[model samples]
Target: MKPAILFSFTIFISAFLLFFVQPLAGRMLLPTFGGSAIVWNASMMFFQALLLLGYIYAHFSIKRLGAKNQSKLHIALMIAAAVFLPLSIAPEAPQWDASPALFVIQTLLVSIGLPFFVLSASAPMLQSWYFSSDAPDAEDPYWLYVASNIGSLLALLTYPFLIEPFLSINEQKWVWTGGYALLVLSVFGASFFVKKAPAAEVTATAQTSSSWAERGLWTLLAFVPSSALLGYTAHITTDISAIPLFWVVPLALYMLSFVIVFARRQWIPSSVWVWLAFAALVPSAYAILLALLEPVGLLLGIQLFSLFTLSVAFHAILVDRKPSASNLTDFYVWMSVGGMLGGVFNTLVAPAIFDRMYELPITLALAFLLLSMHLPRPKFEPPSVSIGKAVRAKGMQTAFSVLVLATAAVGFVTYMQSVDEVFEFTNTMLLIGILTPFALWFVHPILAGFAAATVCMVLPMGYQHQNILMQMRSPYAIHEVREFSSSVGQFHSLYHGRIQHGVQATHPELSRLPLSYYHTSSPIGEVMAIREDFYDVTPVAVLGLGIGTMATYVRPGMEMTFFEIDPQIEKIARDAEYFTYLERCGEQCKVVLGDARLSLQEQPKGKYGLLVLDAYSSDAVPVHLLSKEAIELYMSLLRPGGYMLFHVSNRYVNVRQIVVNTAAELGYVSYFQDHWPRETKLEELMVNSSEWVMVGRNKKDLELQIFDPRWEEQEPDGRPAWTDDWANLWVYMAW
Candidate 1:
């Protein structure tokens, strides 16, 4: 094969393997971390840091070693990395008791670190090698970057849609390992081509002429988009589910930006993209405030589009400022450094310092600053009267600034008056807020960007602050217990990110009633009530302990075990100040703190009469708990005719089919109950709609009168059963 084709193939395959491993590995670790979106962010940071190391290696090799020697060393490293392949987490992988973020990083490093590092280096190293070759395309090796991004885009898009749905996790890992071996051969072949026709020597002056400022500009350009990717990702996933498919959207768009910006013929012109980005900034800023109020699909579209425009605009600037081939590696090294810094800030620093998601605004402001720097200075055809025009412009700028400040002040005051009151005018205020930033752009782009960011970040925070009684940030999630007053009564709610996990009425009389999803009229409640009739002093095991709400069902002499993954959540739920569910139950309940799947494994067989899996945060359901292996485990812990109940209630995903399919595979009968309560005074006591799936060993066990018409026996409809090996949340997305 020709050198150009060989080089392109190597870059493509390397990127394919690199991106493929990301979602694959993240999916594997999801259950371990309780399916928090933070896992994806932490994974992204680890991969980016490794990419930087890989780039540093590539840069050092080209500068310090001869072509033949560099090729030989890289090949040897590839072989060494291959030894760690067929990747699987070690048996002693850190448990939830350890610092989850630190453990996740350590696990990735031990499992796939070396192989990923080698793949990360492949694109830059191959390009450098090609630049030193006699191939006609060597001088302009940048197009290979477009190829690399395309391959990356393909991997990300395919994983959720095709690869994940069809292949088991182990199967995916082996396929990637096989691809890595082939990539090694391709690299060797390309190296042979390089040896036959080597690059001409570069002058010392050519290597040292580039200024530090130029490098800094490159780093800044790369930094804004890289950081924005994670910021946008967290913002979206926090509100929606933290499934791999949602994670894929922002990343795929980020890669698409590179493909468009670095292509030989630009898909979107720089001039057009600059304006598109500016226009997008307003709506994106407005959308932040509307994340909870608006439909998720619309909000998601706004965020993703904003991310795409900003990325393209910044990346275009990076491409335009590219240095000659002699300085290519240096340019990439700085770019990698910027990317790494962005990941570090988004994954590590922001979560540590900020109470809320302040990274989005910070990144937006920085993106605007970089964009302003890159845009051409506004031209003014000689003014008719320079002094008068300048005076008018100054006056307008002052008026606009005052208006913006006054709007912010009013919004803040209204928020302080009542948090729920702010939502009444949020849409109107958001529109004005969106326009204010665009108007300020003409007066001062820097201030405009920051003002836009402040509107997006600070105003929403003000609203959150009003009703939030307590807020805590853990590596797993941002937890908030908020208070709301309605006609029914005042209620205290537990929120994981923006999704309300559990709610309890503040009135002493109503405090014991399960409010959200688990209300007496709901499916899970019906099942629990039926179990009471069938078994005296029934033993129950609840997978999630959100506010310990399920403890309300504990009667005298009844035994209940609560398994929760997040220690912070357990602490909050057990605290009588925040919730009384646990305290109200007296000695009937016990709490087990760990990943429910791992913790459940230690339980005695035939122990519980009913098992309830109510562990869901927003739509961020722990997939591991829903897998075939988990079902079997739950079955093992239950008595012969014992039933298992799953809370499949979610805004984004309909998990009824997944539950039905998994149950059928084990010859267990399944019944789905979807409850939509009326808007009457009594019904208002319940927070929202509920969906539950109950599985039993014998069909007669689920033949209770309450489970008759409402609890329909569902057919799988050819949907693949979810197992520890394979599952895709995308397959069950309600949208």
Candidate 2:
């Protein structure tokens, strides 16, 4: 076989394994961290840091060692890395009460760190080896980078579509191990070809000098896009489930940018990208403005397209400034450094410093600034009598700045005065605010970009500040206790991201009533009513403790246990200031703090007469709780005739089918109802739609009139039952 073919094949295999392992490992760890989007973000940070280290290792090995020595050392390291394969999280995983972000990083390092580091280092290392060889394609070995990203793109696309739907986590692990063995052989073969080539010759014309400014520019170009990737991924996943399908789409586009920009012929022209960058800012701003109000599909499409255009435009500039082969590793090392900085800021710094998602707008502005630097400066006449032109430009810049600030100020004041009304007008002001940056581009792009970002940051925050009574960020999610007032009365609500988890009336008499989706007419209400009728004193277990709203149904002498993952949530529920459900129940309600699945495992079997699964209503469902293993665990905790109720309502995922199929696999009789409150009094009561599925061992136990005629027995769909081994969220995505 030809050396070029062998080298390209090796690079492809390494790239495929590197990306495939990322999502697979994230899936395995999802349940441990309550299926938080932060899990993926933190994991991305770890991988980026490792990639930087790998580049450093490659740089030192090639520059410091002879070809024969480099080959022997790398081959030995590859074999060493294989020892840690068949990857899985460590046995002593962090408890939910502990620091989840720190533990996620720890777990990834121990389980897949060595293998990933070796794979990451191989691309640059092998490419350097190929360049030193006398292969016909050696002069332009960078084409191999395009091959590597193709493999990366294919791996990311295939995981959610093909591998995840078909294989279990354990199965994926073994397959990956086998692939690593093949990569090792391929690397060894490529090294043999390199060893057989003519001795290395040093090029006297190799460019070795690069200014600090050039390096800084490379870093900035890499930084903005990497930050934008995480910001957009988090934005989408927080609205939908934190599944591989959503995580991979933006990343695949990111990898495609590298492939497109670094190609022999650019896919999109430089001039086109500049205009595309400017055009994208409007929709990007619009998307941010309407993020909470717009449909998830439309918002995601706008942000993703904006991400692609901006990334391509900036990365093309990076490619244009690429140095000769002699400085290949140096260029990549700095690029990786920039990428790592972005990850650090997004994953580690932003969440701590900002209350909201400020990273998105900030990164977008930086993209504009970077692109503007590369754009041809608009020619201006000398200061000589052309002070007129300069004066006009300054005037326009000041006017545009005033326009942006005024728009933000008015939008904030409007939202504050009529927080419940003026949705259309506020959205309009925001759209105008985002577009205001484009007008400043002709005067100065940097100033324009900053003004645009300032508008994006301040406007939404004004509304959020007026509505939110208290806000807290956890490793799992951002939690807010909010208040709203209407003609009916004042209402207090709990929100996880944009999803309303629970609501309560502020009127002392009405505070005890279960509001929102838990209204007396909702499916959960019906289930609780049936339980009350059947048993004199029902012992209940609730999976989620959203302000302890379900405690309203517990009569005196009836015992209830609540499992809450986030400590802040538990604190809020127990606080009398937020809601009185838990406080009202007093000793009758007990809260267990930790992951429900693990916490429940420690409890005695068949203790609870009723089990309510309310954990699915948050930003992302804790998928482990919906798996066959989890269902069986819940069944074990319930008495033979006890009911297991799952709240499967979601904006993006249709979890109804998953519940029905899993129930069938367990041989449990399952019934489902889509309950919507009567519209006659909905506005006055603030009732919302809910879907609940009830499962039990004895069919006769569930035969009650409270189960409305509309409630039907759930039937199986053709999709495979979700198990601890395999589950595909794409099968259920509403889009």
lDDT of 1 by residue, 218-270 (tens): 89888889999988888788765455357777888899899988888876678
Clashes of 1: 1
Write one digit per residue (lDDT tens) for candidate 2, span 466-551: 67798777656667888998778899998876778789999998887898878878877776775455653278899889888899
Output the number of the TM-score-best candidate: 1
Off by over 4 Å in 2: 30-45, 88-110, 195-203, 209-213, 237-244, 267-272, 286-292, 295-298, 380-436, 453-470, 485-487, 530-537, 703-711, 732-735
Q: Whole-model lDDT for model 1 versus the true structure?
A: 0.78
CA shift at 710, candidate 1, in angstroms? 4.5
Per-model CA lDDT versus the true structure: 0.78, 0.78
Which clashing pairs does model 1 show?
132-199
Q: Please give the range of 10 consecutive residues that has the lowest summed lDDT in model 2.
A: 194-203
For candidate 2, list the clashing residue pairs, or say none: none
